[model samples]
Target: MTKESMMLPARTYSVSIDRDWRALYEEIWQPEYFTKWASGLAESDLRADGDGWLADGPEGPIRIRFTPHNDYGVMDHFVDADTGSEVHIPLRVVQNGDGAEVMLTLYRQPGMSDEKFAADAKWINGDLKALKALFTPQRGRNG
Candidate 1:
């Protein structure tokens, strides 16, 4: 591979939500809702920035541009750092039986240690769990 072209190691993590695929995508495809579960992307505030958004990440403030709403369940977004580093996050919701499956692909950047990658995977899984919890049925004592 050329120095300018690099392919990073990647992994796709998914969660199953007991909701209709199209309905689930329609409800959660907005960038605003992303902050609710995608902790890795937003630690707190995520405000609009024209076509994209300005969010508070762990390192610092980052710019995120999300794909326009589509008929297909594609919520891909690009996170841009101040240092010119950009991370492509491909998120999707697809039909699984009567429920829906949400998927996020995480890529291990150059110089990222295996331990860090593993931790990132764990973090992604946790985020996916949080997303799943949004649709999971809650049992209250009153019920």
Candidate 2:
């Protein structure tokens, strides 16, 4: 069956980062950088193969296909979870004044309990904070 056929209810969460949109996009919009901030792949090694990316997921190895970078700030991806199901992640980065706002949409799939969904949301929030920290200025750094 097609991955889209298994989609579930989605919830969106966003975080603002004080950095240039283009710079942020260039830095983290690729598959190679996903492991840096995404909690799901935190323990996995990600690599770009052909049209998609290969990585070690929580259950096992998986493949992820991401939308190409565009002017509209879409950074969505389809991840083949170990359950043999494909999960769609919708992400975006839009210009917010002199900075950028990153948004991530999480889908609550079938069989997922309320607590699991809440935990997932918290995890995403932490990941977004980590992303913002990447560009944050250090106390000793000269701007």
Judging by lDDT against the true structure, name the best candidate: 1
What are the root-mean-square deviations of the candidates from the true structure over C-alphas? 2.4, 3.9
- lDDT per residue (tens digit) for residues 2-118 in model 1: 964777789999999999999999999888998888886646688898988998888788899999999989999999977697889899999999989999999998889999999
Model 2 residue 10 CA deviation (Å) reads 2.3
Q: What TM-score does prediction 2 earn?
A: 0.85
lDDT of each: 0.89, 0.87
lDDT per residue, candidate 2, 38-118, as tens digits? 877888888877988888877678999999978777899998866677888899999999989999999997899999999
Candidate 1 clashing pairs, residues 3+ apart or interchain: none
Highest TM-score: give the candidate number.
Answer: 1
Q: What is the TM-score of candidate 1?
A: 0.90
Q: What TM-score goes with each of the models? A: 0.90, 0.85
- Which regions of candidate 2 deviate over 4 angstroms? 1-7, 140-143
Give the lowest summed-lDDT range of ten residues in model 1.
Answer: 38-47
